[model samples]
Target chain A: MGSSETFENELTQLLPRLRRFAFSLSRNGADADDLAQATIERALRSRGQWEPGSRLDSWLYRIMRNLWIDTARARGRKEKHEAPEEEAQFVGEDPRESMDASLELKRAMAAMNRLPDEQREIVALILVEGFGYREVSEMLDLPIGTVSSRLVRGRTALLEMLGGSADG
Target chain B: MVEEEKFFAWLDGELSPDEAARVEAAVAADPELSKMAAEHRSMAAGLRGAFGAVEAQPVPERLQAMLKGDGKVASLTDARSRRQARLAQPFWVQAAALAATLAIGVFAGSQLGGGQGSPIHPRDGKLVAAAGLEQALSTQLASAPANTGPRIGLTYRDTSGAICRTFEDRAASGLACREGGDWRIRSLFQGAEGQAADYRMASGGDPQLMEAVDASIDGEPFDAAQEKAAMERGWR
Candidate 1:
């Protein structure tokens, strides 16, 4: 098979994981799919920039992260006017699985969503995606110390949220 | 405080082996440290459980189709080369190929509901919208409630200045352009009947149908305002 074909196959194998990562970042299924779709388009357009032997998943994650940042910035500007309707529409599109999500998992995701963007992303990369501190630091262009600190804060906050509900 | 950071690093497997061993010893000796470690592990597992279900759900067909070079993101050069290859084929071969594709569409339409009930019918060697499809193309706006009959997707003016719209019913989807007040089937493909409503239009999954759209669309598609305006103008 041709190299681009091989690249597509490898990328296809990564779709499930990519979708999962996108969900963790966006905290909503519709936005996650949109983010994943945009990432795929961008990856295909710039496939030549990727060094074949390096980690494609990490590269794609970086691309997604950058795109999410840009989107989030734009959304921030429009959010005042658009937030209510957008939130209602997203509620309508919430995947059925979320309704069936275990109480613990739902609580966990809710707590994760409450985190500041920086902490949530760091927590997602290191804790959820199983990326190493160094790897996440490199991905976010942050120092290893920052990644660790944010992760600890995120984890603590998440546990605190879960702790209150579990005990109460 | 530093020891607390070390404990988290140990839990994450980020510490060197020697440091991990020391943290492990600390956790084994201190109930409080062990309890915190357990909580951290549980939280991670919960986070994984929360998001991992997305991986288990069927990957949307649109995404799978994209990797197969069927979506718009299929590189321009690839699309150009394919177009060139098609042009290289003789006229009869292309005509025969077109006939075969239309035949499949006819078969699929028949399977859906043949004769008067069929959404499409061959008239004078061209596919024309009929039955419920003709009604939808003439009256249904893309902004209309999606629960109704065959959903209209994009509305745009083709390069020929004729208005066109993409529609999907139960078994098939295709691009039809308004010609002489009848929606003429320019391209049709089978099997998008079961896809999510959002995906059908969002991905434009059927490549041949998308190619028809690409070849003829004058510019951007009609947005909600534009669609309503077009509908008001009777899609003139």
Candidate 2:
């Protein structure tokens, strides 16, 4: 198969996972989708640069992270003082589960939102996306030790936000 | 001899056999060490379980569109252009520009809110989970496995147009639901004592279960009252 076909094929297999990772990072569905689209575009454009035998997901993740950072930088230039208004529409809560699930998830997400961008990114990649420590180090272009230390700190911060004891 | 670092390594299952044996011996002999090890293990398990769920939940439809070539490129380009325009102003002007730009961007972004693309995927007649979220939300609930995670909660559209549930996932995830399909996270409490299997998504006949979640209205789910009533009255 041509490199184009090869890239497309590889991307097709990784699409769902990429989407999930992007969603975790952005939280907003639209932003996550955009990031994924941009990442795929960049990946496909630079398919030649992708070393053979390297993990495709990690490569895509690096590209997605770069795109996300770029978008954040651009968006940061115009950070508004006020909070964005929540959208109006169907806000039907699932009734199957007990009332606690929604409340707990909301609390967690809100706490997660308070984390610094870098720490939040690490948490999303490590905990949310289930990327390995080495892969996260590579994806974020950080040393392995730095990744581990940051994760420890981030997890501690997260625990505190969740109203849990941070020592564990 | 087991060092403090070995605790994290053992919890991560990265300890060498000899090192792991040493740690085990220490834990067996010492109460505090045992407690610490148990707590770490539980915390790790909870974090793993909690994060895993994010991926398992179906992608929302709006996200899907953003991934599509057209929507993303357009959005990026728009944001990029706006940024460039702000850069042209002087330092003092830049401050004012930033504020105005933010206002405009927020207003514009909000206007561009929600999923604009068609909800129905051409290939599948069922309304694609495009707007609020992408993947079928119902599938996440049904496909969740038994003994999967800590049961922090459960949610189902009750007979009163309200969705309600209570519990925590094995990861010590605690959340609650209000309206059917709407979720509100409550508290996230992690602990040292671990005593549960991980939560798993339910699974069976995928297609049938999905259909049931969509079609079956336990009670009037707010806006769908008319349709739900019609169904109850035997919609022809």
Candidate 3:
């Protein structure tokens, strides 16, 4: 197959991962799908700019993160209500454990959202997407130390939000 | 000796074995450190599980269609329209239509609303769709009413949050976003029935027209209750 076909195949494989990351960031199925679709569309359009040997996952993630920021900027804000409500609407579950989990998850995300966008994105890239600090640095175009410091602040904020110790 | 700063890195498995061993020993000795480590592990696992839900979701068919290149037409339609039009064209044409719509939306915007002498002025970002597109979107169901001009395919705020529809008159498929009271033509692709297919033609972009239509909302869209309320309010 041509390189184009190979590229398409690779992109297809990344869809599930991309969807997961989008959901983690947006916490809404519709918005997550929207973000993921926009990201894939953008990655395809920018195919020529992709460095062939570079990590495709990271590259795609970088694109997704930037697009998400642009969308947030365009809309001029994010909301606490939209994400969780939409998630609840989509899942349609009444399990008590799941409900408690959702409430806790919402609190955690609300806390994460309170962080500066830089720290939040770093935390997302590392803990959620499983990117190493080096990979995150490259993806975010930040210095390694910057990535490290942001991760530290992000985790501390999260722990505090969860009512746990922040000193860690 | 393990440095205090190394614990997060160690917990993340980024440390060398020697550093990890030191951290493990410290955690074993300090109850607080051990508790912190467990908490972090639990949070990480919780996050992993939470994100895992999205992975388990079936990728919506519309998304798959987009990936396949021909799905734009398919994207515009729900299952019903898809069934109706399935035999009509190849996927490339659908791709072409979708691509063409975006291309036109880029340069020839203000076609659907907000143009001089046009009936609708884009009050904000939205397109009042003149009276025409608004009514069609609101009431006209299957096709454009036989007497009226063309109709875009099924209209909805798709999963992407855009008010999208396919125009029977491919030229009329341009979209307008509603801002406050007016509609601004973000882009226009094809022409509506018999009118000039010239991408430049715009209906009167009138501010009053949008008001008369009662289309734009300041807050969340009407839920079923609000929809009923609006009907009772006579859509004023």
Candidate No. with top DockQ: 1
Best by TM-score: 1
- The TM-scores of all predictions, comma-separated, are 0.59, 0.47, 0.56
List, residue by residue over B105-219, the lDDT tens digit for candidate 1: 4665564466567788777777788888898888887656357678786778988898898877666677888877788988776644321222222333344555667788887
Worst 10 residues of 2 chain B by lDDT: B195-204
TM-score of 2: 0.47
| Clash number for each model | 0, 81, 27
Local error of candidate 2 at residue A15 (angstroms): 2.6
**Where is model 2 more than 4 Å wrong at Cα?**
A1-3, A73-77, A80-107, A163-168, B1-6, B27-40, B58-236
lDDT of 3 at B228: 39
Error of 2 at B155 (Å): 47
Model 3 chain B TM at 0.36
Query: lDDT per prediction?
Result: 0.70, 0.46, 0.54
Write one digit per residue (lDDT tens) for candidate 3, span A1-168. Answer: 488777777788888888777765653333455577667767876899988777788888888888777655433322332222222233213231233335434444555566677777887778877888878888878898888877888877776666443322
Positional deviation of residue B99's Cα in model 1 after best superposition, in angstroms: 43
User: What ordering of candidates by TM-score runs from best to worst?
Assistant: 1, 3, 2
